[model samples]
Target: MPHHPDLATTVRIRLIEPDETDAVAAVTEAAYSHDYELPESYRRSLLDVATRAAHDQVWVAEDPATGRILGTVWTPLPGERISPLARDGELDFRLLAVAPDARGRGIGAALTRHVIALGRERGARRVVMNSGSEMVGAHRLYLALGFVRLTDREGPVEVAPGRFLDLFAFGYDLD
Candidate 1:
């Protein structure tokens, strides 16, 4: 596949540093809170970048000019096997969020492409993820990037007691 166009030239996508944990959490929580009714456990999971970075590669898209975080995505690396969503031969990512103010600026798409690239580099046969069903804009972006819905894997994931979010699974076959 040809390289995706550089959608946001001013934003640099890289592994976030330790000092930027709070910033990353703020951006992720702010973004997710806008649409998802996050329960306390899920909220804590989103804010715990350090735990994520311990096993997976936690990346962030930052505006180089201001060093402000625009978005974040997590990719499970080989051997860590920490993902609850990825099946064998699939690389999984979670908590892909772009700051509310950064929507429509291509930040989310850029972050998605970055994860796909990482998967390819690591010899992963496919990239998969589960997204909330209500995220129509994110669904559109994933479809535009050539992801296909895996309805067989669709189900409800409980984020808190008695509260569940219907998840739509998507996959990009690298082979």
Candidate 2:
């Protein structure tokens, strides 16, 4: 596949640093919770950057001029297992969130492309992720990037007690 055009040149996507934990977490939480009702448990999970950084490769999108964190996404380390949605030869990412204020500037697209590029570098045959069904904006971005909805994987997932979320699976074939 040809390289994706750089969509957000002003935003730099890079791995998260220890000192930037709070910033990343805040951006993620603010983005995720914006205009949506989130269960407290799930909301807290969005703020758990340190845990994700320890287990997966946590990445951040930064505004180069201001040194401000604008978004984040988490993917497994190269050749490691993380999301159950990924099988052998597949790479998966989760928790793609862009700051509410940064919505129309292509920050989310850049971060997603960064994940796909990471997958390509790791010799992955496909890249996949599960997004909340209500996340219509995110779905649009995924589709624009050549991801197709995996209908077979669409179902309700238990997030916390008494709360279930409808999730849509999207995949991009690297072949």
Candidate 3:
């Protein structure tokens, strides 16, 4: 399918590859700031898993003009946390991010839909994601995309002063 012309004039979504690991990391670092402090090792591990040929599936949105990665998302099949409602099949969207400069341009929404489509293609009956409380906008987007909040848990790990954010778990039935 062609890229959404209205949102990303010359952007295209493609499966992420090993060579694009650095670009994916760059986009992740640029998209998330002050919210979560991911250690270098954690980032490396995520990238490694995302690029792995096994169960991980990563996708990227590239700007045809600059040939740079504008956004990316990855799903881990056979989710880590299995909910009773997701016993059939599910795809956990581990990460969804768009470059700061690429925000408000529908890039995030496009990437999200792309991931959902990917899940459906992989025979997933539902798509799940964990959104931090600090990501209000993202939570709103998920809601708009028909994702319903299943539950929320207070983060035990404190990253900042007195700011104990909660992780809101959202799920979307692909059927």
Which candidate leads in lDDT? 2
Q: For model 1, how does the per-residue alpha-carbon lDDT over 60-90 read when each residue is reduced to its tens digit?
A: 9999989999999987767445546777788
| Best of the two (1, 3) by TM-score | 1
Q: After superposing candidate 3, which stretches have Cα over 4 Å from the reference?
A: 1-5, 34-55, 77-87, 152-165
- RMSD (Cα, Å) for all candidates, in order, is 2.6, 2.7, 5.0
lDDT: worst 10-residue window of model 1: 1-10
C-alpha lDDT of all candidate models, in order? 0.86, 0.87, 0.70
**Backbone steric clashes in candidate 3, count:** 0
Candidate 1: lDDT over CA atoms?
Answer: 0.86
Residue 160's lDDT within candidate 1 is 74
Query: lDDT: which is higher, 1 or 2?
Result: 2
> What are the per-residue Cα lDDT tens digits for candidate 3 across 1-175?
2335676476789887777777787777667753567666555654563444246666788888888888888765444432222444777775688888887777888888887887788888888777776788898888888889876423443435554445777888888
Off by over 4 Å in 2: 1-8
Across 1-175, the per-residue lDDT of candidate 2 in tens digits comes to: 2243554568888899999989988998889889688888988898889999988899998888999998899999889867667889999999999999988877888888899999899999999999997889899899988999988877888878878888999999998
Residue ranges of candidate 1 with Cα displaced over 4 Å: 1-8
By lDDT rank, best first, the candidates go: 2, 1, 3
